[model samples]
Target: MNVFDIFWLFFMITALQPILRQRFLEAARQRMIAKIEKSRGSRVILLVHRQETMSLLGFPIVRYIDVNDSEQVIRAIHLTDKDVPIDLILHTPGGLVLAALQIARAVKRHPAKVTAFIPHYAMSGGTLIALAADEIVMDEHAVLGPVDPQLGQFPAASLVRVVREKPLDKVDDQTLIMADMAEKALRQMKANLSELLAGKYEPQRVEELAETLSQGRWTHDYPITFDEAQRLGLPVSKDMPTEIYQLMSLFPQPVRQQPSVEFLPTPRKGHEGGQGTGLFF
Candidate 1:
């Protein structure tokens, strides 16, 4: 009831409010993860690809799942008990081909059901992994993209098309070499697709789906909406579980990157202070 006591109470509330809120949010996130795990009778695993978002003026962005992500994924999978199903929350722009296939097979062969939840989009390699899931859940607005593989930074289909459109003899030596590489990429992708679709689809549909997805019919980034996926006979549903949304809420928004920084310039041996540029996120 004294003026000084009231003022002290106000200062503490102002200082502690943010901390309290953050703690509450953290607890909620864990609860959501746990609830989803309990409901599915599976351990939850999140695989999010790096977003090409801007970073802080001089900071590094957190890396997302790419082809190199297989090592970590396999480790994570092994950490879980064998009896638990895998509730995979997949969000990626796609990465390495071999890496994707490794993950897809792991999920497909797992004894328990693997349910893939797509809150927004999963493209290329991400699509391959989703196909491995027993069930894929998405919202009406969510999308799964085409599975056309990328060879390095180049699109496999484009590379193959160039060779198809131009006669091999007409092209230069370098072009011929690239065309050969492209041909190999196409063949490898076909083989991978066929294997991936093996147990998931009927013997007939498997071939058809593989051709449609990997034959460059659609662009690599083309968004296949929930309705389109269902039409294609994928095991997909538009109704996403509430727990999934709650779990997604814990992550930085799609456009936002966690604050991080990486310094460039390899510090030489015996070098004390090497100048470096900073990438901010």
Candidate 2:
């Protein structure tokens, strides 16, 4: 080929490399999903969001659970046979409350068992969705967060508390209005959470759990570990499937020119060559 023709061919391959790589990764994920489904005899649905970078521009974009996500998940559930169980793999930092509620209600209504697997963290609305599952399987160090509602940038519970504690004259009119809305949001969240927890826990326990989760007892980003979750009477277990981890690896963060973290892909033991080695820092 002439020099110009060779250059054109090279440019085309370079431009298509990212697209081809993404397609290959998606196909790999599908194969892994099929393998997991076949082994467990259950429907697998993933609600994962990563801070992805825009192609070419390299601008970071954060994804959250939204109406679109809820629609897709509910549709997936509808397609599933009522007799088949479902395994939802969640890895998110939470999102819209309405969207989360929609997904949670769908999970609660399914006739067969539903299991939520958290390989990392699922906060806020993500935690709300987890509450609807019959069982929660978490990695040993995985965490969940409070399901408290938020009003704009502030927590709904906080807004209500400020209104209650502060003098009426001291609070601004806008603040007063937000506080009123906050109270309603809190009540709605508590009721919905209780509904999801109903039948799974005792009547009294359900009320207590709902209050604790929706009353803003913890910060929005507070992490609830497996032990803490169990102490709170959540149905959580540490039995993460290996394939789940494999599947997560396929959904990588957007690549940067230089990686921030790097490590050798080899397992290390305390002893090297069958002999204890001197400690090094």
Per-candidate Cα lDDT values, in order, are 0.78, 0.94
lDDT of 1 by residue, 96-174 (tens): 7778888998888788788899998888888889998889998889898887766667777787788779887787887
Best by lDDT: 2
What is the per-residue lDDT of model 2 for residues 151-199, given as tens digits with 9 covering 90 to 100?
8899999999999999999999999999999999999999999999999
Best by TM-score: 2
Query: Model 2 lDDT vs. the true structure?
Result: 0.94
lDDT of 2 at 96: 95
lDDT score for residue 1 of model 2: 92
List of clashing residue pairs for candidate 2: none
Give the residue spans of candidate 2 off by over 4 A: 270-281
Candidate 1's C-alpha lDDT?
0.78
